[model samples]
Target: MSAFPQPAQPSLFGDDGPLRDTREPVLMSLNPVYYDLIWAGEKTYEFRRRFLTGQSVRWYVYLTGPVGRLGAVIDLGPAVVDAPEQIAEIAERTRAGNGASVFEYVRDLDQAFAIPIQRVAEYPGMPLEQLRTELGGFHPPQGYTRLRNHPDLLSICEKVRADSVRREMTVPGH
Candidate 1:
């Protein structure tokens, strides 16, 4: 529930210059983002706010486990992307013996890890072939969870497409 759906500009918009990333399997999910003033000030006005507030704890409450804050492992294992402390919190919840909480937590993690990584990229750079491989067989189905959970795949895909542009920039045209 970010206050912003899409950033007003791309991460590379400012000529602070493109980051020199030549590594494959670049894990962009862990990258940090800037917060708007209100969000930065602890207003908790984003979609995730529902959990942070008492209104609804289920959103991220999986990290806390049932019966209120179980253990670290139970919560952390399910998290596709979270801090070490958060993972630890989940594990702790598992030890507390919350059957419902532990079950919910484990399910989410499996979903995250099983996610076809190809979805991490988009049209231009989205490792389409890679996705097909991970997804199994040719032509992945629409509404793939890999695409749903990892939206960054689109931006990464677009950025990767720029590679051909880079090559064309230097190579002599036919």
Candidate 2:
């Protein structure tokens, strides 16, 4: 038998049908510097070689250690795919100062894409241990994955989304 227990079925739907879940799972192996920059709203775009094409994917940040946990949900704009120089131009137009970093990350690659992101909600995050317990054996994705495909992770993300909504509703201004 497996050492870790499987997750229960996700209660992701209402009587009508599946709830519209816009959030997508993304495991970013980010350094603290980049993480802080993204959180601070200093960085507006995330560089990547590939992203889910022709899809509206809002990234759920799973910040790698030394702060291993689920951090925030960011709605991503369309992936702007082009050659390195072209991508840099787009970044400059968007006023993203991290354009140079994008070039660096895509140095060897002929083409790359940048996903513009705005933080929808930020949280302290679920620790790795807790994540492992919930997911039955969580390993950070080397690249990224769609959370909807992973029942266990999707369930946790759904809770996170619910909590975020609840917190917003309880707030005085919201």
Q: What is the C-alpha RMSD of each candidate to the true structure, in Å?
A: 19.7, 10.7
* Local error of candidate 1 at residue 7 (angstroms): 36
**Over the stretch 8-37, how does candidate 1's per-residue lDDT look in tens digits?**
553554533244322222122210121121
TM-score between model 1 and native: 0.17
TM-score of each: 0.17, 0.73
- Give the residue spans of candidate 2 off by over 4 A: 1-29, 92-97, 165-174
Query: How accurate locally is residue 61 in candidate 1, as Cα lDDT from 0 to 100?
Result: 10
Candidate 2 TM-score versus the reference: 0.73
- Looking at model 2, the pairs that clash are none
- How far residue 113's Cα lies from its native spot in candidate 1, in Å, is 7.1
